[model samples]
Target: MKIAVPVVDDSLRMAGNAGHTPYFAIFNLNGGMFKTFALEGLRANPKVVVGEDHHDHDEHHTCDHDEGDVEHIKAHDTMAGTIEDCDYLVVKMACKNTAKSMSNVGVKLQKYNGIETSASKVLSELASQFK
Candidate 1:
């Protein structure tokens, strides 16, 4: 089975929030061995600037939904693609929208207290559950 964990860094030492993680650590479980890879693209916190107001002119600049909305969609798409090949996803926290998306794609979501735990430790605990 394959498990994907959202990691805070490339070292995979910390678990990150599902929707906002910058990288995903994918671990493939084969017999007693494990192989892992890192996926990068998504941003944990994307800055969305609405607009800038100019005092000289009575004009307000604002971003159209076309730009912001498209980026949002693309981010989710990238995230989905990152974990598509995995059988399971482990996250410290996930929003309802993210959970719904995972469910739609048939990927099982596992919740864990990952704040104080490392990715390897969490994976080990999950493996023990199957045994």
Candidate 2:
């Protein structure tokens, strides 16, 4: 089994929110032994932003979606694709859209409710559960 957790920096701290985190620490489990698999960067899926007058914007921005935004859907689709090989995603917090997108791709979302924890620690706890 593979578990993906959004991370903040090289220290491998668990990111508070998955939507904006740029890195993911992947853990691989085999026979109840878990090991670090990889540290992956987020794959970019750029959106062409056109202004009201039909001019493209130079800066990047996350579009505010109201349940049916195509751009929003595409963004989450890309996010989900980043960890598509993983069986589960462990996050401290994730927005509704992110959770929905992950679920759509068959990735289970696991929430950690305690204080800030490192990705390694989170994987340690998860390994205990599978034992």
lDDT (10s digit) by residue, model 1, range 44-129: 32322113331211112222234346666565555666677677888767655557567767678887764455777787766644
lDDT (C-alpha, whole model) for all candidates? 0.58, 0.66
Clashes of 2: 0
- Residue 71, model 2: lDDT of 78
- Tell me the tens digit of each residue's lDDT in model 2 across 6-102: 7655677776777666567777766534443444443321221222232221124333566868778788888888788878888777777878889
Local lDDT at 44 for model 1: 32
Clashes of each: 1, 0
Best by lDDT: 2
* Top candidate (TM-score): 2
TM-score of 1: 0.63
Off by over 4 Å in 2: 33-64
* Per-model TM-score on C-alpha atoms: 0.63, 0.72
